[model samples]
Target: MTSIVGYARVSTRDQNPAAQEAELRAAGAHRVFIDHGESSRVVDRPQWLACMDYLRGGDTLVIRGLDRIAGSEVMAIEIVAELGRRGIDLRSLTEPAFDTTTPMGRALFSINAVSAQLRVDTIRETTRRGLDYARSQGRIGGRPTVMTPDRVEAAERMRAENHSYAHIARVLGVGASSVRRALGAASSR
Candidate 1:
């Protein structure tokens, strides 16, 4: 037997899922899952994972809107396709056209998937250009190293004393990678 499973989500803790829950219940959902303070860009959502684990083949997954499942159309289409492959259905209460049970819904999602891929490609290209410009200006990205000059000196002295990289890192309150790099750089000079 197929069961209706509803899900609600809020991007931040300050938002509430009460209204979505009410609507899902009204739509005949027997169980509702919610995720709070979770980003849609992140796939490792706790509540969503739980909802997936509980869902069985032939069950319908319900949501207030498509965006509740995925922020990007590509991801949205992929998720729906995955569900379809599992013999599951997807429905959105707000968008009547968002019903995957209908041919129209399936067509729309296919088009949206292409647009989503384009969007992802555009973002990657723009980011690449921006990074290139930043590099040309001598502005580097990424977090600065934790190893200071004093730490480097200490690391060198410790290495000369035959201390292990892990031991040096523990005494300096840094990582073994940092110790190894510092020692390697000092020796190279």
Candidate 2:
């Protein structure tokens, strides 16, 4: 004897879950859990956690749509796999093809999940390559240096004349550490 459990969610507080609840009830769901003003990106929704706790091994978890459970394609894949591991089947009221009980539905889901993962990997690789190219072209990122060659020369001369690094920094309007480092590098050379 398997029971049908349902979960519903809305991303914002202003939106209502009435229509989704009605649909879930109409779909023969024995009990429906709901979340308001919650994002699907979060794995620990109060209603979702309650629904999971209420679910048994011989049960089907129903949702109004895939987007209700998954914020992204990667999340959809991970959630479906987790449900399968828990011996809980997933069904979508709006999508007949979203029935995990069928072989065809499982195959379609696998294809979609793999494609989404590939898209993410490709984007990451492209970004890495672009950054590497920029570095090779001498276009470094972040704030530019304030230590000019002239400043280094002046700081070195001041140090040779027994002037303190702090005094040199105050005269040049730069950091004492910068003056010290410049003088140290000149000494090292």
Candidate 3:
């Protein structure tokens, strides 16, 4: 007999999985597997792996939403395709059109998956091009360094006066490690 298995995931430990579990149970899930503090980007989540292992051919895999199973469009497509290969059906409680029990649903899902992947690929390429353009214009990204030239000069003067790294850092309003690193970098140059 084919069974209905449920899978749920929460990104943080502080989040409660009770609501998801209750929804799955109400949806007639014979067994439910949950992963707490697990990111959807990770395919090797402990409970997810166990859920995949426990599933058999003809079993229906149910989830509250696609985001519970995948972090990206590529990941979601791969999972849905894998379910098809395993002779298991996928049904999303929130996304009725994603039910792959019928031929129409499967076709529509495949088309949507491809569209989603294309959008993701386009966005990534556009971002890459924008960054490249900025670099060509001599612009740099990321946060500015805390150790400026003036700070380095002051740190060196403080060190030469035989001040402790902790004292220098306190006076400089930075961390002890920052003072040490600045001094070390200056000496190296």
| Alpha carbon lDDT at 110, candidate 2 | 76
Which pairs of residues collide in candidate 3? none
Where is model 2 more than 4 Å wrong at Cα? 139-189
Query: Highest lDDT: which candidate?
Result: 3
Once model 3 is optimally superposed onto the true structure by TM-score, how far is the C-alpha of residue 66 displaced, in angstroms? Answer: 2.3
**In candidate 3, residue 74 scores what lDDT?**
88
Candidate 1, after superposition: displacement of residue 97 in Å?
A: 4.0
- Ordered by lDDT, highest first, the candidates read 3, 1, 2
Sliding window of 10 residues with minimal summed lDDT for model 2: 140-149
Tell me the lDDT of model 1 at 127: 97
TM-score, one value per model: 0.72, 0.69, 0.66
Off by over 4 Å in 1: 12-15, 125-154, 162-177, 184-189
Each model's lDDT: 0.89, 0.88, 0.93
Winner by TM-score between candidate 2 and candidate 1: 1
**What does candidate 2's lDDT look like per residue over 71-146, in tens digits?**
9888888888888898998899888778887888777777877888999899999999998999999998766556
Candidate 1: clashing residue pairs, number: 0
Expressed as tens digits, the lDDT of each residue in 80-178 for candidate 1 is: 888988888899998887888788987876777777788989999999999999999999898898999999999989988999999999999999999
